[model samples]
Target: MIVAQRHRPSSSISDDFETQGEKSFLRFLTCGSVDDGKSTLIGRLLYDSSHIFDDQLAALERDSARHGTIDGDFDFALLLDGLEAEREQGITIDVAYRFFDTEKRKFIVADTPGHEEYTRNMATGASTADLAVLLVDARRGVLSQTRRHSIIASLLGIRHVILAVNKIDLVGYDERTFDEIASHYREFAKNLDFITAVPIPISARFGDNVIHRSTNMPWYQGPTVLEHLENVPVDDAYIDSPFRFPVQYVSRTDRDFRGLAGQVASGKIAVGEPVVVANSGKLSRVREIVSMDGPLEEAREGQAVTLVLDDQLDVSRGNILAAPDAPPQVGDQFQAHIIWFDHEPLIPGRSYILRTECDSVTASVTNLKHTIDIHNFSQIAANTLAMNEFGVCTFGLQSPIAFDPFRSNRVTGNFILIDRYTNATVGAGMIDFALRRARNIHWQALDVSKSSRADLMNQKPAVIWLTGLSGSGKSTIANTLERVLHASGRHTILLDGDNVRHGLNRDLGFTNADRVENIRRIAEVAKLMVDAGLIVIVSVISPFRSERQLARELMGSGEFVEVFVDTPLEECVRRDPKGLYKRALAGDIRNFTGVDSPYEAPETPELRLQTIEAQPEALAMRIQEYVERRT
Candidate 1:
């Protein structure tokens, strides 16, 4: 759950209310285990601050009556328990977002669930938080769950911690109870790399020093929780930090004008300042700061604004804008801390679509270093990360990318792994360090033309990519074609979906995305082999047409042949060559393609085989004949 750190501190507050009513806001989240009273604490803050409306209060009163409470006393927990299950179980389940304003600033509080099951949701909530409020029960003190929460918060880049020792009333409001809990929290927090921490004792139910002064706790002398939140001196929000503006959207209001639109994640930006894009590392200058209303002289960090550049650049979504003074490195490899959220574990060597602020690239996990034990913050050797597990790993991107460390800038450093087939986000990664030095193998480009390579290999460097349901004889026909070509003195290579995996694609699996990357790597290797003057035969159950199109693009027209082994799904399931179809039908597998996934059949193919009735040699001769005509 370690996330990107760093924020731009506000240098000066604007007092011009009439011309520009720009108000700064701080976002924070509260998270912990169940029975931690996070909802109660939030409700107390809102109620004591008088932020609730009259009608809302009346509804709350009615709800309290339904719950069998007399006198309609404020059920502080009612403010955040919006879900039916939450009210019934009296436990928070989802990340409930609430907004309230104070005289000093605007606040957005994300009340996230405390259950270990919902750790991913909690990480999502705290990903955007500038600070975190961690609650500890005086009786339980700092338990294992407490340690887990603190570790996650710290790893998520929420540097500031305000530990609230709730239910002090049960502890006799004793100073000893308060001190003991505080001491334990301090010791646990010391192991984490936190910026600042403050522990305070209060009874959330009795409203002791939450917002107003508590006469019951006369022994404690310090500012109330609200006071500390309001007046705590935050460093320059982003002025001193490196500039990072992730281009979220491109705006072109008129045919004559164009601009890049996104929020400034960190640092300040001014007109004519030189900027570099992380994708291409191309430098440019800021021509104007385009706001919603009009142009601005300057745009500070955290402000969502459009930027007009002096030069036409290849800037797009998933790209970052940085100051020229210290540009970020553009590379394809890096080490990162990943919080895996999907039910399917991460597969090493399988390429996924890695997306950050404005840049997206096909990347693969090169290695999994180790996972951190949440309760202890100790490293444990793990092959794959399951749901809510935090691990350090190295990744290999397809293209070079420039990025700052998550500790330096949160916006440009955070990334999500998307399944190319399912489009589901599988993992959240924070760039720990970009490993620029990776081993590279250089292949000598022959002076022979591509067509010459095809001739030298005796067959054209073309990809006969076979795809169909399992047990479709895709492998049988492809193997037959390879032998016939060899007898004809035509050099060819057959990349069977399962066979090449032993060496070329050994690190991938059968998930939707992994399958796509499986085919992608095969296609890439096929292209290279095609360049080396060998006709490539690839047999895989590439169910998606989009992936086939990608393969086609990689090899170019007339090179990539989509050969449909048109076998019906029902027939293949009946065949059950690998027993996968039987398992899928038996409900042992959930995301099995051709059953759970919709396999898009090719509308057009270079060749089509209805069945394996034709002899393998006959099929091979037919493919060779087709190749001869094309060449």
Candidate 2:
């Protein structure tokens, strides 16, 4: 019989996996937009680890003969180019998953495509990765696609990043070159919120420092590719993240046993422990924990175990079981960061499926806050998340669903959006806020309306609406100014371009009418919030002067602080830190601002600040001065 290695959990089960010596496995994915050598890197890891089967090797040899060899040897890419179309084009066009095991642990690697058309597939591949091994070629270094993947990884709550600097041989494996790449990547990583990150140098083609130490690199002294995978501190496993087990299937056996069956997604559960059901809010005791082998004393995270409760509870698929001490909140609305993968933009009123673990519900895009420029990590005013764009968007669920913050429990908090007709997963979302607090605060006709409350609080509901072109430093200035006002005990809210686009404004598009509507909605919301006694600050690339004027008309006179975050188009495109300017120049993008659309400069404004120096501090102080004068 072929031996299948089974990982045994440590006895005397402490919450910490380190104490038990049972190193939890992390499934990491390698993703980029395109031409990032994702498949070749996976093949290199598989081949170097001596995991290639004899038959697979024979097939590779035949393919190499048929297609002609790259270096008169087997081309590893031949193994990963699965689809006939992909083989013909010699590019990864689908999500390709490969599995291997090292002495220390087992690993499941997914090599995802980096093409714009395969964005949905990329999301599917990366949805389950505990860590994302984002690859950047030494020749190309950091590209827009690289940044997109990094942002997605962060938004998806992939806590760890192993930035594999692939194709080091192309850059002569020079230490200076590697250091430069690492330095640039480090700067980018600052924009992300991962728990830990490590940059490593590797030549996937030659298998340099993959499974074994590299002979060519004398300057680099670190673990091999396999070693890093085997021993990069597997402390990030979500075993302690408050027990969250989504009931996948309920079983009623012939014997007197009815149990809830599903994978223990996070945390531990012991027999006789008080557990809370998420959907029904019913509490019960875990009489026994069952697996394929029958009864068990306890079950830990990531284990596919079933539990028989003492009381016969009405639990079904999508229902979550949690510890009573830290029960998950159930809500019909959740604030999430979504990445739009559909060809059609996400319509705010349209309903789609939001799938988290075993739970699936119809969810509507309640708000599209803002869209993020993945390159420079800046926000832009966007009403809808177009194809392959990342944004912060909120979803209104069909029913109350139990979930925790993605930061606390990824399995419980993360969800995927699906097209109803094709059942195709079009987007991935990470929960930011539960929205239950908003429910409590949104009681109609109870004590007071939100606007009246704000009025009583002595703050007019107004958005210090700042409008400008790309690279106008709207966020930088707004953030600094908000901090100043907040320090002065003025209730302030800074709605930045990128952070909001990721959520609230995600449903709006870049078209002229869409842009107008986008600003209109934000202005209305800002007015309500101001009426609720908050000094709301908003920064957006609102190109249409008429739209800005209309938003101003919505607010009371002097309440609307129309600030013009002015930076010349030439300088804006020059700073093109996000490389959007390069994409626009390449003719890959259409209807791009400053290229296809006319940007009307504000004729008259309360404040006009130049952002040519990339310093928003001076502009921020100017705005602070204006706010001080007004208040």
TM-score each candidate.
0.77, 0.66
Angstrom error at residue 595, model 2: 23
lDDT of 2 by residue, 1-631 (tens): 1111222233312333333355356687888746667777787777766667666767767777676236566677777878888877777888888866655776788888888788777777777887788888888887788888888788776778888888899888888888888899889889798877788888877888777778889998977767777876666467767888899999888678788999988889999989999778889999989888877898998789888899988899889999888888889987888888888677674557788888888777878888888878788877678888888877787678888888777788788888764577788888988775457655455566656776666654456988887776777778888888777777878776666667887986677656656776777778777766788898888776655665676677677888998888888788887888778878877667787777878888888888765467778888877876775
CA RMSD (A), model 1: 7.6
lDDT of 1 by residue, 195-292 (tens): 88888787887788788777888898987778777765555556778788888888888997899999988888999889988667789999999888
Clash statistics: count for each candidate: 18, 32
Deviation (Å) of 66 in candidate 1:
4.4
| Deviation (Å) of 570 in candidate 1 | 13
Give the TM-score (vs. native) of candidate 1: 0.77
Each candidate: what lDDT? 0.79, 0.77
